[model samples]
Target: MPKGEKVKAILFDANGMDREIAPLADVAHIPDKQIYWLIVSGQGAGKLPHPADGIDRAALRRGGVVVSDDRFCFSVPVAPNEGGHSEDAMILVVGRNWLVTCSDAPLSLTERYLEHDTGETLKGSLTAPALAVSLLLAHFDEFHTHLSAIEEKLDALDEQVFRSRQRHDPLNTLAVLRRRAARLRGLVAQHRSTIAALDRPDFGPAVCEEDRHHLTHLAGAYHRLVDTIDRTRDAVLSSYDLYATRVAQNTNRLLQRLTVITVGIGLIGALAGIFGMNFELALFKGEAPAFLMVVAGMAAIATVTLFMATRRS
Candidate 1:
């Protein structure tokens, strides 16, 4: 619609045939029953025509939704990476016969959704609300794929922390995973609320019974997604606990060895101190034989102390 903006539009006619069209072409020529889907990428969202009055551009950028009598508009976080980092918000505005999607970056999931065979089959059954639901479902699928990757990482971390002998500190790695999971959970929660709003009786353009059923199912799926994220976070926390416990145990073992060495050194120092006393006894007055006996006694005491220290229960 504007310079530096990338837009793609697909028009679905009453006969169910779909074709690409100029993104900013005059849609007034199309019949009211036909549907057009517009996908706009980059800094163009602010320049695109407003789908309805009272839609806040700031809210759309920050991730929010507004519903009206004939249309609804919402912005949702899109995670294009397997790391579950949401780079931008995807804004969608849907009316009776048209849907407009805008994002700051290209959405790979959207591309895949369009290229898949499912997209062809769904063309015949498509309505504005149904298409919106399908797009949202694709986003959820991306989230699931990201979550699956996270779960695998958690498993690997668990193995490294508990099974391996190498000293590994998973605190940093665990912290990162926890943060990602938390962010993912927040985005999914936002989507869950958006779906709930769509499922409400007063939601506009008035969702049909079939679309309403899909929304219900999507809501249930979002609930499960939230639960899965929570469980993954708990696992991270538990791994942290295990890691802390292992570190403490290793520290105690080190301290125990140091204590033994200190005790042995202390015993040898005491023997030397006793021998250095200025008493004129036969032990102190004797020459090399007495010195040899002192050395022998000190060595015996040090050996016994070390032996006792190292003995296991």
Candidate 2:
């Protein structure tokens, strides 16, 4: 295991020549020039059952903090203080020697850096800490990508609701999308603080002008992403409301037609029921069949009258 270096100033990245490197299990040491953002696991992490031989055969829960120097590697998953960390992974500064990073959560930003062409960029760096900061800055582009995607989806949904001649339930789609947005929103908000802490004058404290600029840019990106999420949420709600109104209007029109038909049918039935009575009458005595026929004619006449009334209504 490596020993950690004393915490000092923040390292900056002026040029975008950030590189990616493979993570190690634990840090051997940290250099004085780098930042040590640590990702340790919680004590009670992992869901695996314990073995009789006392083997901790479970994944460790993640607990994140900034470390000045440590022996742990960035990829080294540690035992967390509490639950299994499937949400976020961790990163650490290996005692003035290397920058280690690990995470319980799936981070696309990490993937982005790893995909860069320069497999040797991280390895070729003059200072390991500075290299780590560069990789971290490069990773921010991924967050921005996700944020933009969410916004685009919301905008598309808004167009469908407003312009589509066909109507559908906007609530279902909107609700789900809103929830996802909220989740990302929370994640970004939390990340902003962490990154800000890295850039703070007193905290990790940037070393040069370049690192300071990179940190500032990262903060700005966070603000922009957050604003986009908020606007998307508003658009989702607006689309839902508009869809609701259209649905209500369609329902009311259908009911109005049904009501008219019902009234018409009721009038004709009433006329027939009244005439159907078997009460004795001088005119109906001998010509009972003829009297019934006349009653039928009157019912027909009533039906026509009811039809016209309903039509005009």
State each model's CA lDDT, in order: 0.73, 0.49
| Residue range with the least summed lDDT across 10 consecutive positions in model 1 | 117-126
Cα lDDT of model 1 by residue, 2-33, tens digit = 57778788776656556677764454455655
Quote the positional error of residue 47 for candidate 2 in Å: 22
Q: What C-alpha root-mean-square deviation, in Å, does candidate 1 show against the real structure?
A: 4.3
Return the clash pairs for model 1, or none: none
Off by over 4 Å in 1: 11-36, 45-64, 68-70, 80-87, 95-98, 117-120, 163-169, 273-290, 307-313
Poorest 10 consecutive residues of model 2 by lDDT?
A: 48-57
| C-alpha TM-score for every candidate | 0.76, 0.52
RMSD in Å for model 2: 9.8
**lDDT, candidate 2, at 260:** 69
Candidate 1 overall Cα lDDT vs. reference?
0.73
Clashes of each: 0, 48
